[model samples]
Target: MTEPIRISRTGSVETWTINRPESGNAITGKDVIAAFEAAAEGANADIAVRAVILTGEGKIFSAGGNVKEMADRQGMFGLDPIEQRWAYVDGIQRIPRALGRLEVPIIAAVNGAAVGAGCDLAMMCDIRIASERASFAESFVALGLIPGDGGSWFLQRAIGYERAAEMTFTGDRIDAPTALAWGLVSRVVPHDELVSTATELAERIAQNPSHSLRMAKRLLLESRTGTLESTLAMAAAMQPLAHADAEHQQRIARWRSS
Candidate 1:
């Protein structure tokens, strides 16, 4: 069997594809978790990797959790509820944890249906670009399941509490335009142009000095829950290090000459 997650590099951008197209990229087992962890590790270790684009292969982005696994109580979702809880903490939960620590920027290229866990995965990324064919749902509620992969934490933050509440309660699929209207996605493009557009955006971001890029991402992530005073303090602390870098000096010189 081929690897469920495929990594490809182009310049400073790393692209991760959820490769189980036949099954609609249904997330399961250690493959997805290991993939996420590896992404974090590789990006952190390599200064050249400045951005990441995540999407699924073929048509469907992801069908969220494996329904067959859930039905049969196989893999992570065993017969016991406690076993399920442990599975979440040690398994799927690792995706969010690893992603949260990743300092490089990530753009979710939502090419098709991003249901349940898939939707949450997109929310974890710093930016999202959706194809016209893309759709989304907080769909676990329909199956009597909850967002076992930090959906509750990421949803309200991305689209506000009220919009998040509606999606979670109803479990209704929302099209790409609806996602754009709700601020869930930054752009909706023609299906064929999705990857190219996302790649262009990633390349633009990657052109910046890697150290400053990482620091800027770190500062923004900190600001999510930080007060104005605390945020300012963080900026003050970061400024000295940024100013000391040769890359910042060169950029400053170029700005002066222009």
Candidate 2:
């Protein structure tokens, strides 16, 4: 049986690929939870892995959910339609929360179409790099649903409230160039070079001090929801530990010698 997700590593960069290409790489609710769990565990346990790259196996990154599975589940349970849909929402919404808590940086290599929850997944990552052929859409509204997978949070933070509202309301698809212009992705590259460019960026990040990188990620996450005064206090508490690290000392000594 084929795995829903595939993991590989290149040096300190771990790559997780969504393997269901026949479905436009769509992820089921179960798949989203499982993928996030596996990726988070792998990144946390391996000291050698300083960064992670998320992508999809074939032509598309992800089309979002497995609609056929949804249909089958509804048929099997014969449950109230609203209740069944809520179950689906609960399962898939955990993915972004898991990604957000990861200690290391994540780079989404958007190879093709990323719609609905798929677009949320990409936006949750620390950085996104897209291929020329990549497209994105906040497609939930068109289906009479809302962004359930933390899309509202990440999208609003990424491109601001107006743009997020526009995309979510219209469910309009945006190409890579427009995505970049709208600050959805960090950069766009040719289709053939997407993986290479993303990998290169990951490698560059991995070369930095891993502990410091993790701490910086924590600080950045904290700053998002923390009040200015609280953030300042947190930073003050963290500063001494950062300065006391052996890596920090070594850099200081080197600077003094120069």
Against the correct fold, how does model 1 do in TM-score?
A: 0.97
Listing every candidate in turn, what is its Cα RMSD in Å to the true structure after a full C-alpha superposition?
A: 1.1, 2.2
TM-score of 2: 0.91
Residue 85 CA displacement from its true place in model 2, Å:
6.4
C-alpha lDDT values of all predictions: 0.92, 0.85
- Candidate 1: count of backbone clashes, pairs at least 3 residues apart or interchain: 0
TM-score of each: 0.97, 0.91
lDDT of 2 by residue, 180-239 (tens): 999999899999999999999999999876777888888898998999998889889888
For residues 122-173, what per-residue lDDT tens digits would candidate 1 score against the true structure? Answer: 9999999999999999998899988889999999999999999999999999
Clashes of each: 0, 0
What are the clashing pairs of model 1? Answer: none
Error of 1 at 60 (Å): 1.1
- Scored by TM-score, the top model is 1
User: Distance (Å) between predicted and true CA of 73, model 1?
Assistant: 1.1
